[model samples]
Target: MTLSPAVDAWAEEEPGAATDRSGWPGGIPSRVVRPRAVIEVQQLLAEAYRTRTPVIPRGAGSGLAAGAVGVEGAILLDLSALDRILELDADEQLARVEPGVITADLDAAASAHGLMYAPDPGSVGISTIGGNIATNAGGLRGAKYGVTRDHVLALDVVLADGSLVRVGRDTIKGVTGYDLVSLFTGSEGTLGVVVGATVRLIPRPARTATAAAYFADIATAARAVTAITRSGVRPAVLEILDGRTLAAIDDLEGTALRERGDALVVIQTDGYGAEEELEVLTSAIAALATDVQTATDAAASDALLFARRRALPALEALGRVLIEDIAVPRKRLAEAVDGISDIAQEEGVDIFVFGHAGDGNLHPIIVTERGAADDPVPDAAASAAERIFALALELGGTITAEHGVGRLKKEWALRELGPEVHALQWRLKEAFDSRGILNPGSSL
Candidate 1:
């Protein structure tokens, strides 16, 4: 097939730094394409589509699930080179950016104008806006500001056939067409390639307050989470760490958190209305927690939040970990925690649990000793994860809350959706990519 010299210039044989943090099972791509412009991306896709070569859109390589893991002889479309903030209109409270723009970089730019981009995944420092949109990511602030879908105003997508289509609106409200923006937000690159997005931003809050609430046990802490949201206290950040997680923090070099309590709940209230919000949160939490320690300053709040920030890394220090992101109804969080602990005990697996408790989203890490390179995930570890997935579904919860259903959880996701619904999703996929060239074998 004939191609533009510019598109051919984008090819590289080696994956380079793009594969550094990915869980891409060593499936080497035939070529990695790093297009710098939308037209180049279109040309590359057009050739790949005509050639019937599989293509996987990739950004940052920070994804935990193997969503970016490619099939043999595939073309990995590396978007990082396309990073550019095309426009930022403070008056419109809107920003137009290419797919490769880092999430935190955009937020920092927005902050200069007293505006904020809200869908912050834990890996916001390195995760890309395109990846966030693909996953519909959520974070600590998600309890109030919502996820990526909430902030995305519109998207410019490249379909499998190399046609570019713009969907959604810049205005906050519009019923002009079918909600294609929502349809592609969490599609995981299957339906189309998201090349650009117009995102909504919110005004920055003026004042804020924080508190670290201590609970006798996880169930009590979990119960307070249910109460805080229902009590009309909209906390900007509400995180929880169980006893095991606290122990990990204690073991972390230069940290002293275990002495505080077996279960810890960190809360932050922001905005001009923060004073009243802080009072409501503290009062509601004080009723349940053994003691509620309010932060006297931002430093204190940071100290309180430090343990949560280090939870996953601290667990990773022990060994390899498969983090699970399952969320149940807020009322059932205590039960979910208990059920997860029970699974760990039965499976002989070491599991550390913690997450954004305000929304009942939990990240239960299944810890195991590190194995040799190229070794598949251990059978015992895989079985334990399956059990956890089963428990979440039994409790009327989703298998994934913020994380997309990548290669790791695709089978379980199919089980969760059942046959008819799963088939319907495929029909949509077929309508978009009839040859199944886009990120095949990922979330349906």
Candidate 2:
């Protein structure tokens, strides 16, 4: 089980090996291989497959899910070294990128060509494109722009047998075969390693506007979100935050959020219809708000949107947070939120709620004591998370709107997928990786 000096040098369990942002200090790997080229990946996988070694493909490791945590005696594929933008076809509005390219970096590059990558996950700043595709991550703007899967056109995958195979079509409208692009996109590396990808880009919005609608109650704020959605006003982004989250945000920036309201809705309108759409949504929201204020200028708009984006970070200040990505019908968001709040009380956990209300995706971040992550008060946090998932399911919502079913949520995934479909998923896993060498303990 000896690797070449260069291979070992490139990916040894040395001092340079970085721990991911996930903060899950789990198992130590037999080897951490950073492939410089596709051939290197092919060679590594070929040997691993022959030896029946476990391999886990990893990117920037911004994932909170334990999906990429290396198994003992496994080979951890560090894809960050493969970062590259192979091609950007502005005319076709497509970008060919290596797996390790940072998500936000691709968006920035696309913006330069008058195009923009659609998915804007919270960790876009450092998360990899391959990781996003692996999770099909949703963003604040997912209500309108959709998730990472919607933009993925094709993929270059390295299979367990060390074969470099291409799945999916480069064109936008291709249904010639099974949709492997979509299939593999959210497979979370259990099936294969995504070496490269062709991603679709949309035209950048011509203009953008934002408004903050404040409500005395969370139900009213959610009702405003539903009304805005039903009013034919397609806001680029619509977010709602509970009073606790709003108060924390004010403390973070000295904003008057706590003084203004207990709950707030932040809406952003974009494209050529930016102003017109905002006008309609704002009017609708005002009818139900204790006070509604549209950002009078672009600076103010940016501030409002920035505040909404800061929800997760502000919550982190209180304690270690287990952020939940659950989504229900937009009409049922307030009910779901209320039930989530009840769970916090029942479980004796501090829960701050916020998310894209337009699409019904909510983040119920469970906060616990800082150092408690190792072993303190696990019951309360665990119970809160479980109840949140159960409540989401009862409300006809998914346990995870965007986050993949990693090691953390595998149990819930089993409950959600059921036996028949779960068995089919296992067949798919077997079809691509019969030996179970690729991402063992991931996906199915």
Candidate 3:
């Protein structure tokens, strides 16, 4: 396929070349297109559509799954160059930003005006707002504020035919048409490429408190998460780490969990100087924990929270990581944890588990030694990964809770969604992308 002259001049044709390595899983894309503006993206997309080339729309590439990993002949549209907070409406509590604006940057900007974006993925520091919107990412705050889809008010998307279409309304509430915004949020670029977005923001909390609790077993810790949910006390962030994950974190941070407990539950709550709200949450946590430690100040609380957010990256350094986002009923969290443990043991793989326990979304990362890459072990890892996903399905849970069905999970997506739903998804894809050129092999 012949690329446009301008696109050819701007695109990087080197295989496995990426500006940032942290975001990509297996490696970088085969070709990278760094478009400075939406029109440039339009030109590139037009060429790709005409040539029938697979195009992978990439933001920060900080996704846990290999969502941004490019195929042999695919083009990686790196949107990082489009980073811009185009507009901020304080009165409306909404912000319009280009695809490449870093998630944390927007949050910091909003916070300066006494507002905050709620959907914060662990990689918020570097993950782009477009990526967050595409994946409908959920972080620690999800328990209280909900996922990316909840805050996204509107989106400006580039269709498969190089046409631009705006979906949803900037207003607080509107039911004028189909909820296409919701459809694209977690579509993983299969339906269309997001060029820009309008996200809702909430007032910045005046005060916040953090507490960490230790449990003798993972089951106890899982129960504590359920207890918090059952109690109707919503925390801004709630996280749990298994013994293996704790060890990985200690190795990375050069610190211990004080109690060396089998499991640890970290909870944070925020509001308008609601110390009493925090107190009640901490008290309930203490009831289910062997040892509870509450942070007295913001700095200390942030430190603890940082550790939880860094768990995935820290564990990844030890080995090749396969991150799984599986979620089940809150009350059945223990069963899910036990089932994962059983799978890990049966597969003879070292698995580290951690995630937003408040919402029952657990990320089980399978870490294999770097040496495993040279032998048949990678195959073993792949097989074990499949089994883990199947286990989640068997438990009546989703194979993916927040991380969307990227390339790695596409096969299982069909299994999870079934034939009827899968066919309908295909129909939707055809409607939006008749040529089947936009982000092939993703989601549907």
Relative to the unseen true structure, what is the Cα RMSD of model 1?
A: 2.0
Please, what are the lDDT tens digits per residue for candidate 3 over residues 2-61?
344544332345444332232333434456777777887777788788888878888876
Looking at candidate 3, the ten consecutive residues that score lowest on lDDT are: 16-25
Off by over 4 Å in 1: 1-26
- Candidate 2 deviant stretches above 4 angstroms: 1-25
Model 3 residue pairs with clashes: none
Q: How much is the lDDT of residue 193 in candidate 1?
A: 90
Query: Tens digits of per-residue lDDT for model 1 on 34-90?
Result: 777888778878888999999989888777677776567888888887799999999
Cα deviation in Å at residue 57, candidate 3? Answer: 1.0
Candidate RMSDs in order: 2.0, 2.1, 2.7
C-alpha local distance difference test of each model: 0.84, 0.85, 0.80
- lDDT, candidate 1, residue 117? 93
**Rank by lDDT (best first):** 2, 1, 3
Global CA lDDT of candidate 1, please? 0.84
